[model samples]
Target chain A: MIEEVAVALDVGGTGMKCALVGADGVVRHAERHPTDAGRGPAAVVETILSVAEGLAGKAYADGLTPTALGIVVPGVVDEARGVAVWSANVGFRDVPLRDLAAARLGLPTALGHDVRAGGLAEARLGAGRDTGHVLFVAIGTGIAAAHVVAGRAVTGAHGAAGELGHILVRPDGPVCGCGRPGCLEAVASASAVARRYAELTGTDTGTATTRRTGSASDDGSAAGPGRGRTMVTAAEVAARADAGEEVAAQVWRETVEALADGLATAQALFDVATIVLGGGLAQAGAGLFDPLRAALRDRLTFHREPRLVPAVLGDEAGCLGAALLALDQMETP
Target chain B: MIEEVAVALDVGGTGMKCALVGADGVVRHAERHPTDAGRGPAAVVETILSVAEGLAGKAYADGLTPTALGIVVPGVVDEARGVAVWSANVGFRDVPLRDLAAARLGLPTALGHDVRAGGLAEARLGAGRDTGHVLFVAIGTGIAAAHVVAGRAVTGAHGAAGELGHILVRPDGPVCGCGRPGCLEAVASASAVARRYAELTGTDTGTATTRRTGSASDDGSAAGPGRGRTMVTAAEVAARADAGEEVAAQVWRETVEALADGLATAQALFDVATIVLGGGLAQAGAGLFDPLRAALRDRLTFHREPRLVPAVLGDEAGCLGAALLALDQMETP
Candidate 1:
């Protein structure tokens, strides 16, 4: 008998992480494709459809029955309606991705927000697996989160839930990409850290050091991806802080403090048992975790301090989560 | 045939609102009793048990079958285990209220948190009735919230979810009863408005205006209730603001701004379709809603602004919620 698999795709701004995942969560096959968002959303959609068909065909050739298709994209996704409502990077506005994929592939399909999908995977299979309630914060160019409860991520009423990055932390802080002043993303996101560090060090954003591109990295801003396009990465700032550089240390402290404040607010609202940190900034590891943990503790009162841990699934969490989402939909239906 | 009903109790700091509600949500009978919390937790427990038993007896005497009992209390509740983990007003510490009520009344019992119960009722049957996702905020001496998704309140991992009031908003603001500085509760609660007004007017808290005694009102703080004893009531402050008093206007503006900030954060995270405002201050009607709605709209960017509405359930919401809880439990079981 052939094993059953889910055709999954975790679409980001610059690249798409595609995979064939078994029902047991094991990856049978995986591949990647450039999104080339500059070519526009229509081209991107076509590319996505083509990639999904190829993967489905690959599964058949490998003697595996493709049970379903799952696609996770950045931006506001109405998971219930199977629509990609709005995305800044992909230029999607009310695109019925689920139905399109389902029609094109002739399989049951699940569409989810990328961060939410990643968070679901993290909560169910990564660092938050032991906890029933998990908050997955991905600190890339723009920060975003997914609140996973009992293994299901909450997609807000408008399919825009878990916008942790936009929550106001500093009333007079910098303006966010969303045009809001003092948003958490503006103060603590990887891009924010790098921007602030550059502002202090007198470096330019257009021409500077390269930001690393992860296997499944996502830039949640509407403007698009920022890979290899920064004066300095958040990791370099962390390194500088560790090396006892004054400006870098100050920037790092400010970033950690803002993140702690944001996480503290999330804790008060969701009361999750664990918070998993992911994305480019999370690559700093202990350098980010130690200070973040202490700061989060100091801010909490009667609220239980959430366990702060790093996401262990690396970049493939989103693809795995896409698979999980498809499996979940099938089970529920 | 005897009509089946659920005996419900909404326990607050100063009073207990008791009721018998049918499965269709119609109230058959209702009454209130003074809590006299100064009598301590043990005596309070006994009183509660006696009251619930009496209600059950009354149901039988009135030709209605008492099917189950539901009780809502303030503070940290472990709903899964039916334990009133900790409550400042009720002085509860790990009291097995559900089991106690169950044993006494010989009926299945459900224990719930007060604000969450109110939120549940509001979402299912009141102002939030039209929406599937709602955040019910009770702004009394302190602020608290319940995130209701599809008529179910999120109890969180530790039964302590939806602590919106404790979220940090004004980091430079006053210290809260919970020993935290700049919490939304400290900056925007009814008591905060009254206290700020008093400070501006130089009125002493021990002897001035009286905060009204509300039915089914719970003070959600570990430091206990602060009602009737405040310097000036938030209602009076609202009146002053409406009368164009500069100091009162400033206080009201600050409160509105903080509340807007808090709600925006909630919207960014929960993306609910509606926000139901209840408790003492919401009684201000348009005075609070008009400006609050505008402020909230100003703060939102990509997120949809939740419909700001006053809770229509008034005092019986908690009791009704308790009844609903029992009914939900029975059905699930």
Candidate 2:
């Protein structure tokens, strides 16, 4: 008897993580491929299709029947319409990626926003499991959030919900890529931390220099893709902060405060039961969680304090979330 | 044949609006009573019970059958538990008001937060009717909001959702009632407008003075509530701004800017299809709507611009919303 599975993909600017996930969410097969976004969106789309087709073929050859396909990408996704509305990272502009995948794979396909998909996975299978209301915040190159209520993430009217990173936390703070000054992302993101640390250390090489040297592209920037840079990462800054470096500590402290403000704002708005921190910055572990918990608690007044935990699935969350989305479609349909 | 109806009451710190609403949402009868909060929480609870019972009695007398009772109050409410968790306005703390009403009236009773209930009514029956996603912001003494999705208002996990008033819009602006500096309520609420005008004019008598002499009491204590006073109301300030008063224009312009910032943040977060502005400041009509619409549009980037409109239900929204809640309970249960 052939086992039933879903083909899932988490497509980022620099790379894609694909998996053949069984009904129980176990990965039957996993693969990683460079997105080569520098080659343009057309090549990237073709690569995605071929990779998905290969995954399906692999499943069939391995005595597994692929029942559905799920794809998650960075950007605004009109999930209801099965369209990749816009993504700066993948260079998707009004692409009917879901329908294309469904037609190509001859399977039911679901497309979702990368952050939202990860949030769904976390809410259902990771740190926030069993928490009816979960807020998953990804703080990396750029900040984004997903509000999961009763196991379903809210997709705003324009499919632009959870833009927590853009909420203004500082009025006279740094300028965000969105052209606004003092956005939470501009002040608190991991990239922002590295940039601030570099600026304070007088090694200010600008975002372009960092991007050219960094390993990953952020969701906020619309710049061209390049090789991962070999430069100072947010992890190094965290290490320095932990080592009692005054400047690094100051930057980290500011990051925590701004993040607390943003989270407090979210708590005030969504009032979720749990807040799961994901992405790169959350990797700071205790260094990030300790102060963040305290700061968020201090800022709250009458609102119930939520359990703040680090995301457990790490990088696999997106792919798993994509699979979950596909599974949900099957169950609902 | 007897008409079916629900007894609805919108309880506030200063007064209560009670209504007998028919199945079609029409108000069969309406009445108002002073809350007499100075008499304390016990007395207020008694007043609420009396008012609800009176409405039910009135329904029976008028050849109508009261099927259920719905009451909306300010502050954190545990709707699932049918308790008013914490309401500073009505001095309710963990009061099982839902059970009390249900037991007394011998009918199913629903409890809700005032703003959330109002948002529900607006989304389902008022200005936001036909709009699937609606954000209803009430800019009164303090700014508060309700996020209504598909005709249901989101009551946060702790039932403390929609505290839009507390979102920070200005970092170095003013001290909010929540002890936070530069909250939206501190900068743009009706009380904030009056207080700002008072500060700019150097009259500085305080919110109590304005309310004691002004026509309305805002949620904030920055200005006093009473009949349009010598201290000048937010409405008077709008009139002055309309007549080209430089100081008033400057104050009004700042208020609009701050409100726009807050609304833009809300738009980015909720991405709702319609934003219904209610409360006293919204009573400014064109003076508030035109500039607020333009300012919100200017601040938005890629997010869809929501339709900004004045709330049509006026002060009756809370009562209507309460009725809607009861009606909803009847249908869902």
The TM-score leader among the candidates is: 1
Tens-place lDDT per residue, model 1, B85-125, is 88877778899999998998889999999999999999999
Off by over 4 Å in 1: A204-230, B204-230
lDDT of 1 at B122: 96
lDDT of 2: 0.84
Please give, as one word, the docking class of candidate 2: medium
lDDT of 1: 0.86
Error of 2 at A99 (Å): 1.2
Task: Give the Å error, residue B20, model 1.
Answer: 0.7
Candidate 2: where is the Cα deviation over 4 Å?
A207-231, B206-222, B225-230
- Against the true structure, whose lDDT is highest? 1
Clashes of each: 1, 18
Span of 10 residues, lowest total lDDT, candidate 1 chain A: A207-216
Q: Model-by-model lDDT, in order? A: 0.86, 0.84
